[model samples]
Target: MHIRRICESEGDAAGTLWDHMCRETGDGRPLTERARRDVSRMLAASAWHRDAFCLVAVHPGGRLAGFVNGRISTGDGLLPGLLGEIEALYVVPGDRGQGAGRALARAATDWLVAQGARTVRYLSCAGAHDDHRFWRSLGFEADMVCLSLYREP
Candidate 1:
């Protein structure tokens, strides 16, 4: 398996994989809405590809097994400098537990470090997810916890 930057030709497969990730942690939202939102975000990233990064893992037979996205930012008012963030990561069920995820993450984080990021951040999806442990295994420690309450009136 090889990990590398995303290419234009893989757009459709990558989009599908991204929508799948959204659905997994999206708390039952409709797929159409998810696709809409993912596409918009992807277009924005594609618009300024120099400032953001996306990586994909390919299986031996040339299928896209998983993908990750990240960006280095010239921080917001509070942070005040360049910061690296692991924006999104997902691996197909068939490819999990075999180090593909780790390799993708390492490539992104290493790139961030090379870009002079002193601080890198990542937020796992919803409650008590198993991937939290996966992030920890990569030497990442939780810096904060966020809680939310959703209601309908």
Candidate 2:
């Protein structure tokens, strides 16, 4: 597999994987229009168009296997520093455990570092089963947890 920077023309593919990953990880709930719009903005804006970076992994036959998107940003006031925030990382089922995720994350991390970020961080669902082992292997640790309380419908 080969990893490459994502271009604006790849929005559909990236957005498709992103929406799927979000739904898969969001307790099976579909995203609202507002959320979809936000994601659309993110997908359309890359390092060339915005302060963000996105990388995609390509399979041998040129299929897109995974993608990682992140942005350079100052941390929340509480954290008190500049850092890169990884917004999404998704690997198609068939590509799991094959290093595509790692390659994409590494590329994103490298891009963030190039943009002057000394640290990179992302949020994950507290109770979700995921390839966090992959993150841990890349030197990421659970520095903190975000809490959310949603209305019961």
Candidate 3:
């Protein structure tokens, strides 16, 4: 798999992958139209932002196998210096374990480091054993756990 920065023309393809990620990891609800638009806007912004990026892993046949979006920002009051976050990462089911995910993550991390990030972090889905193991293998340790409560209107 070849990894590179995502191009402007590939926005739709990235959106499709984002939907797949949401479906696979989310609470079984499809993304609302507003949510989809919001993601599209975010992706567009990443492409133009110096401190943010989206990288895509392409199959030999020119298909996108996966993508990872990351950004650099000031850490919360507790942590000092700039922080790098792997905002989202998703690989097509068929492409899993073929190094696309790792390559994407590596590329993003490298970019973040180049941009002066002091530390890199990512949030994995709770109870996602495989996902946890994958990040751990990459030397990422659990720094914190986030809990949320949602109520239907």
Candidate 4:
């Protein structure tokens, strides 16, 4: 497998792969078709795409097996401080346990640090799972638990 940053020219492929990963992980409750289209649009919007860095792990046949997207932003407060956040990380089922996820995460974090970020963060769903250990192995510690109350739209 090969790991590298994704370029603007690869936006369509990246968006399609991201949509597939989201669908698989969300079971039957994945984003709506409109939302998926919106995601693709966002990927092509240039502004948002430029604000974040995307890392893709490719297979020998050139298929993307995993990816991570992150951004570094400063708070809007009076005294703004930089924060690095990983918005998504997904490894296709066939690529799990092959270190693709780790490589993508490492690349994403390193890119964030290069962009002048001081701290990195990612969100994992509630309840324990092997993924928790994966993040821990990457030197991430559980800092706080957040609860979200949502209403059906």
Candidate 5:
């Protein structure tokens, strides 16, 4: 298996992967009406591309097995100058246990660290739902918990 960072040339592939991730999510909210406006604004963004990163894992036959996306920021002061937080991660069911997820994660985290991130945070909400064991096996420990309070508009 091979893992690598995504580039502009792979926009379609990345978009497809993102679509798959969204579809796999149980969340019911559709894309927001404001998303178009957000995209217009994001088109003018320079740091968005620089701060954001993605890693993709390919199977032996060159099929995309999984991917990870995240950004390195100053939030939480976990690392040094930048803290890496994983925003999304997904692996096809058939690809599980083959190290695709791990390879993707390692690539993303390595890039963040190379960019001077002192801390890496993997946001596993709902207390690790299904892959807690996988993360624990990777040597990650929970140092803090985030609680959310939402109000219906």
Candidate 6:
């Protein structure tokens, strides 16, 4: 598979993949209309953000197999230096384990390092053992944990 930045014409494909990812992660049966719109806005804004980018892994036959979105920014007040974040990463079920995810991640992290990032981070669902392993294989170590509580209306 070949990896490269996503093109303007491929927005819908990327959005579809994003929706799939959301569902797989248990976000919604089908993403709410507002959620879909939010994702579209984020993807559209990526092209204009110099510090952010979205990359796609394409099959030899020209089908998109996966995508990763990354960005570089100043760390929150407690931390120093620039930070690189892997905002979203997903590989089509059939394409997992074939290195598309790795290639996309490597490219995004490399770009962030080139832009002077001092650290790279990705947030996986707390209980996602497989996802955790995939990132660990890439040299990422857990440095933080986030706890959340939900309240019914």
In lDDT terms, which candidate is top?
Answer: 3
How well does each candidate superpose onto the true structure, as a TM-score? 0.82, 0.82, 0.89, 0.82, 0.75, 0.89
For candidate 3, write residues 31-150 as lDDT tens digits: 787877777667766767788899999988889999999889897846777899999999999999788889998999999888988899998778889889989988899988899999
Score each candidate by Cα lDDT: 0.78, 0.78, 0.85, 0.76, 0.67, 0.84
Instruction: Give the Å error, residue 49, model 2.
Output: 3.0
User: What lDDT is reached at residue 109 by model 4?
Assistant: 88
**lDDT string, candidate 1, 37-104, tens digits:** 66646734643487688888898788988888888887773675679899888899889989889999
Error of 3 at 36 (Å): 1.9
Query: Residue by residue across 63-152, what tens digits does model 5's lDDT show?
Result: 777777778789965445778777777787788887788878777778888987877778776745666666666766768778899999
Comparing 5 with 6 on lDDT, the higher-scoring candidate is 6
Error of 5 at 12 (Å): 2.2
Off by over 4 Å in 1: 33-48, 149-153
Residue 20 accuracy (lDDT) in model 1: 76
Model 1 residue pairs with clashes: none
Candidate 5 similarity to native, TM-score: 0.75
TM-score of decoy 4? 0.82
Report the error of model 2 at residue 93, Å: 0.8
The 10 consecutive residues of candidate 5 with the worst lDDT sum are 39-48
For residues 1-153, write the lDDT of model 2, one tens digit per residue: 899877777776777777778777646766676776667567767737557877889877877898998888876655545688898899998888787888888898888888878778977776654666668889998888677789999
Q: State in Å the error of residue 45, model 5.
A: 10
Q: Locate the minimum summed-lDDT window of 10 residues in model 6.
A: 40-49
Q: What number of backbone clashes does candidate 2 have, counting pairs of residues 3 or more apart or in separate chains?
A: 0
Candidate 4 residue lDDT tens string, 12-122: 776777777777654534667787777656554533464677788888888878778877788453334677889888888888987888989888888888877777888
Ranking by lDDT: 3, 6, 2, 1, 4, 5
Question: After superposing candidate 5, which stretches have Cα over 4 Å from the reference?
Answer: 28-48, 60-62, 76-80
